[model samples]
Target: MVERIDAPAVGAPDPELKNSPIFDESDWDELSLDLELESGVCYFNDRSYAIGEFVCSGDELLRCEERGVWIREGACHD
Candidate 1:
């Protein structure tokens, strides 16, 4: 037999907590570090790349991921 524990449902706000704005406009401005990031693009060395795009850094080849991050795909060849 499994024991069950009572708990609040997911996404349900707590009654004891006060509801207020988590962040102001100024805070949002500070958090907006990169404009390209808002467009679902990756930035490398001052260049913006689309998702699934590949780039070469020296000899290493990198692929742009969905989260605006570059991942190593392989080595660049001539």
Candidate 2:
């Protein structure tokens, strides 16, 4: 199942890959990194991110750290 969430804009969709273009589970194996997340902020690397984690989205970087989802300026959006 894919989680419903927007891709943070901090990383700018990797610039290499288009956000609209999606891949299947099988293609995930081809990627050296674990960009296998269905939703929520993620990267093209072999690592996983947890909810309530820092993510940049909506053309801006959002921090989901201890303060929870928020704008870079520390605004609580979550």
Say which candidate scores most in lDDT: 1
For model 1, name the residue pairs that clash. none
Clashes of 1: 0
Q: How far is candidate 2 from the true structure (C-alpha RMSD, Å)?
A: 11.8
lDDT of 2: 0.38
Give me the displacement of residue 65 in model 2, in angstroms.
Answer: 12
Q: TM-score of model 1 relative to the true fold?
A: 0.48
lDDT of each: 0.48, 0.38
**Per-residue lDDT of 37 in model 2:** 31
Q: Kindly provide the TM-score of model 2 when superposed on the true structure, using C-alpha atoms.
A: 0.23
The alpha-carbon lDDT assigned to residue 35 of candidate 1 equals: 39
The superposed Cα distance between candidate 1 and the true structure at residue 62, in angstroms, equals 0.3
Best by TM-score: 1
Deviation (Å) of 16 in candidate 1: 46
lDDT (Cα, tens digit) per residue for candidate 2, span 1-27: 544345443444455543322333354
